[model samples]
Target: MNILFDVGASGGALLHNASEMDIDLRNVDVIVISHGHYDHTGGLLDALKIINKPTAIIIHPDALALKYAIKPKFRLTGVPHTISEIKKHGGRFLVTHDSVFLTDSVATTGEIKRETDFEKTPEYYMLIRGGKVAQDKLLDDQALVINHEKGLIVITGCAHAGVVNTIRHAQKIFGRRDVYAVIGGFHLIGASDERIEKTVESLIEINPRIVGPCHCTGDKALKIISDNFAGKFTEVRVGTVLNL
Candidate 1:
């Protein structure tokens, strides 16, 4: 079954590019939103339109909450599309706080457990309510786990809950220790040197066959991961497709 982990910032453009590669958007059976961030869910409404058929949208219920990044400057950074808009486009929401199986081999990470002390969500991120801003725990952050022949493949959007945490959660949920690969954002854009080092150390312990860091993963963090993983690291891009 064809599954889209997360639509890019532009749904129309992503569909156009997919068409160029001969990928039919209508074939998509599931759409998983990693988090509520705009960069991840901006194209969701458009994607619903292209699919035309009933598509299951796997996402954490908290994703619908109001969230924003307070650092640098105040701005709206949550999902740009509303629930009504999603329904208007024929998207079926499977909102949940527990792991959801899209098919026999595919599942959602649900809400990842934050076990790492150093990999805390940035304090600058907040959830606004009645003009009162509080720290955003980003509980909506989740990942997609695909069980393959070799091992499990974890696909993330902006991993605000922590990439290591996401991988560990996937392992526990799927009852698989072998992680074939981890693709997508690590959310270490402005992480400290110590945090990056610790994150790499944890990743080494739960070593996967390949690592593809993209989107919100910072240059320093990417470099660190590359240096550690060496040949196992792959550059992830919009048009990049993995056979597994």
Candidate 2:
């Protein structure tokens, strides 16, 4: 099985370009979205147009909404997708706010929950419902976990829910502590040095064989992982692929 990341950039890319990278789009049985950000979901239209066959599209429920915050004067800036538009291509689409099975050996950790007090989503956006603004808990932030014969490999997108928490949730869902590798964005662009250090410490315990940090993880954060976890670190780009 292969995990084809058609849309990984913050924006400005196409799912149709999979052919350019030598990825057989038809072989893809599943399409997993990390979050609701436009850059990630922007290529859905193109992808659905290409994959004419049945394919399961997985994402968090909160991602399908137009959300806003109060402290920031209740501005709406959420990317919400209509069910009709998602199914416009006449393909199978699976929606859920909890974990779902990808294959017999792989599963997607729906929304990584906040298990520790230190790990928290930024308090920037809030949901506006009935003229009431509430804390926007990104309950849709999820990751894909592959139970390989060697060990578990975690695939994440922006990781808005927190990378450490994402890993912990995968561990809880799989009931295993052996994470072979982790690839994708950690969303540490604007994080503090202390937070990054602690996060590194937490991940070090997992002893992942490969750590491919990309997208919004930022240069400084990636450098920290490179310097500290030298043996296992790798940089992720648009055309990166891994065999499982």
Candidate 3:
């Protein structure tokens, strides 16, 4: 099945890329939103219009909740479009909070169970829970797992749930097996030096064949990760493609 992961920050670029790459957006079987963050969900409505059909969209229930950055200037950081807007454009929501498979081998991690001490969530982001505004644990943060013969390929989007924890969650569901690839944002931007160091070390321990960290992963962390992984590291970019 053709699957489109996270719509990106805007429609212009996404649509352009689809056309240029000869990707028929209309044929996308399903679209998965990594989380509620605007950058991850903003292009969804536009994409739905392209599909022009009742397309299934897999997402976390909490992804629809209002989100904000409490400090460094209060700002809305939640999904830019509403349910009504997306539905009007042909989105059929399949919301869930537990790991759900899209295929026999590919699935979403749902809410990652935090397992490490160093990996932490954004303390500045806040969200409404139980009718009270509180710290946004970003429980909606999730990853896509593709079980391969050699191991698993884990893809994450702004892993606010923590990279190590996210990988571990996938491991738990798929059985503790070798990870073939670990890609997507580590979300370590502006994180402490110690945290970055620890995260890189943990990634090395995971020993994935391909390490392509991008998006919100800070430059320092990326450099360290690439350095440590060496020949195994793959640079994630707009035109980058992986055979797996």
TM-score (C-alpha, index-matched) for candidate 1: 0.94
Once superposed on the true structure, which residue ranges of model 3 sit more than 4 Å away at CA?
none
Better of 1 and 3 by TM-score: 3
Question: What's the CA error at residue 244 for candidate 3, in Å?
Answer: 1.5
Clashes per candidate, residues 3 or more apart or on different chains: 0, 1, 0
Count of clashes in candidate 1 = 0
Q: For candidate 2, lDDT tens digit of each residue in 1-244?
A: 6554435442225643566787656676778877665667766656666666666777776666667655537555565445677687644656787888767878889878787555677798666546676777877788888887778888888788888888888888888889888998898888898889888998898889989998889988999999988878877786676765
What is the lDDT, from 0 to 100, of the residue 49 in candidate 3? 85
TM-score of each: 0.94, 0.87, 0.97
Off by over 4 Å in 1: 129-133
Backbone clash pairs for candidate 2 read 68-126
Ranking by lDDT: 3, 1, 2
Candidate 1 residue 189 Cα shift, in angstroms, is: 1.5
RMSD of each: 1.6, 2.8, 1.1
Query: Residues 138-217, candidate 3, lDDT per residue (tens digit)?
Result: 88989999999989999999888999999999999889669999999999989999999899888878889889999899
Q: Rank the candidates by TM-score, best first.
A: 3, 1, 2
